[model samples]
Target: MWRRRAPLATACAAGEASLFVNGIDPGYSGDTAVYGALSLVTRADSILVQEVCDYGNYDDFDFTGTSMGFGLTRDDEPPPLFLPGVIISMFGGLVRNIAGHVGVELDEMRQRIEPWYTDERIECAMATIEPGQLAAVRFAAVGVCGGVPVITVEHVTRLTAAAAPHWPYPPDGHIGVHRVVVEGEPRVEVNTHVSHPVFDPTDAGCISTAARAVNTIDWVCRAPSGLFAVADIPPTELIRGVMW
Candidate 1:
C-alpha cells in the first residue's frame, strides 16, 4: 500500500530555501484566484469563490456518506466540516489574507449553511440517498469588513448535478469547477473546470488539489524560508516537470 508521513523537514534554521503549500480552498481560490479577478476591476463591491461539484461522481462511498454526511437525514447532526468553528478555523486565514490585500480590517467572520433535502431515494457514486435525506448543501464563510461582507468562500456540493438549482454554478453546468465571482462594475467570473480522463469530478478535485503543490514547487523552493500565502509567489508561465 502507498504510505506517507508529514513533510516535517524544512530549511527554516538555515534559511536557504523554503517549501510552502496550501491544499485548496481559501488558499488557492481566495488567496490566488480572487486576486486575479480583483485585478480586472477597479471598483469592487464583494468577492465570492465557490467550488460547485456533484459528489456523486467522486466514487468514494465512505467519505461522502459518513464523513460528509451526504446521505444524512434531519435526525443526524451535520458533518464536522459544518460544525461550529470548523469553517472559521479552516478558512479564516484565507479571509484575513484577502482582507489584508483589499486593505480592510475585518469586523467579524460569519458562517451560513443551507441544506437541500430530497423527497425521493436516489443512488449515486458516493452514497445511496433515502427519502428526506440531504441531496446537497451550501456552506459559506464570510469576512465582514465595515459591516459589509466583503469576502466570501462558498462550497456548493451536491449528490447530483441538479441538486442546488438556485445556487451559483458553472456556466456550462459541469460537475466540478472552481468559480470566482467578483461583484462589481465590469464584473468578472472565472470558472476553472476540472476533469480527468480516468477519474470523475470528485477524484479530479483531489488530483487538482495535489497538483497545486507540485506545480508551485519551483516557485516555492527559490523563496525565503517561511510559510506562503497564494499571493506571495506567482506560478510559472507553463506546466513543468511532467511527462506526457
Candidate 2:
C-alpha cells in the first residue's frame, strides 16, 4: 500500500495536503479503483473482511451519498449545522471541482449535539482523511476554550459514492482504513462515510487505508471530560489491539 502521514496541523495550515491518502487526487480517479489499490498503497487494506459494506442493512443509512457536515465547538458557538439527527461519516470522501469548490453549505441548520464548552474551547484535534485520487480536500479546525481544545471538520467535494446521501454503501467504490489518531485534545473524534453516488463517486477508502500509518502524530490536550467524541474508533477489544 502507498502510504503518507503528516501532522494534520502543519499540512492543513497551507490547505495543500490531505489526511489519509496523501498524494491521491479525487477529481479524476474512480472510487472503486482507489479501494482496490489500497493493498498496494499501505499493505493494510487486506485487513477489511466485513467492516466496509453497504448501509441498506443499517436502515439505509449511508454517509458517502450525502453531503457531510462535521465540526467541534464550545457549548456557546451556535451549533455548526442546524440539521437534526445527522451523523457524519469518515469513510466516505468528498470530491472537488478543478477550481476547488465543494458545492455544499457547511453551516449548521440546527443543533444536534451541544458543544461542551463556551470559551473558545475548540481547536483542531487532528484530521484522518483520504485525499482521494484527484486531490480532494478534508479540513479540521481547532480552537481553545478554557485552556481546552475543540476540533471541527469540514469537507468539500464534487463527487460521491452514492446517488443519495443516506444509503449504507455507495453503488460506487470507497477506500479502506486501519487506524487514525488525532492529537491536540487528548480526546479523539473519528468520523467516516460509507456510501457515495454511483455516477461520480471518488475513492475515499484511501483515507481509511491510511488510518494505520505510524509516522503521523498530533499534540494531545486535556478536555473537560476524559474522553473525546468520534464515530470511527476501531474496536480494540474486538480486534485485540491489532486493528490493521
Q: Please, what is the whole-model Cα lDDT of each candidate in the order they appear? A: 0.74, 0.25
Give the per-residue lDDT digits (tens) of candidate 2, residues 16-100.
4334222222211212222233324422211111122322112111333222322222232333232333322221122111001
**Model 1, which residues run further than 4 Å from truth?**
1-11, 14-17, 24-26, 237-239, 242-244
Give the distance in Å from residue 122's predicted Cα in candidate 1 to where it truly belongs. Answer: 1.5
Q: Which ten residues in a row have the lowest lDDT in candidate 2?
A: 91-100
lDDT score for residue 235 of model 1: 55
Positional deviation of residue 147's Cα in model 1 after best superposition, in angstroms:
2.1
lDDT: worst 10-residue window of model 1: 1-10
Positional deviation of residue 100's Cα in model 2 after best superposition, in angstroms:
34
Candidate 2 regions exceeding 4 Å error are 1-63, 68-143, 146-150, 154-238, 241-244
- What is the TM-score of candidate 2? 0.19
Q: Which pairs clash inside model 1?
A: none
True-structure RMSD for candidate 1 = 4.9
Clashes of 2: 75
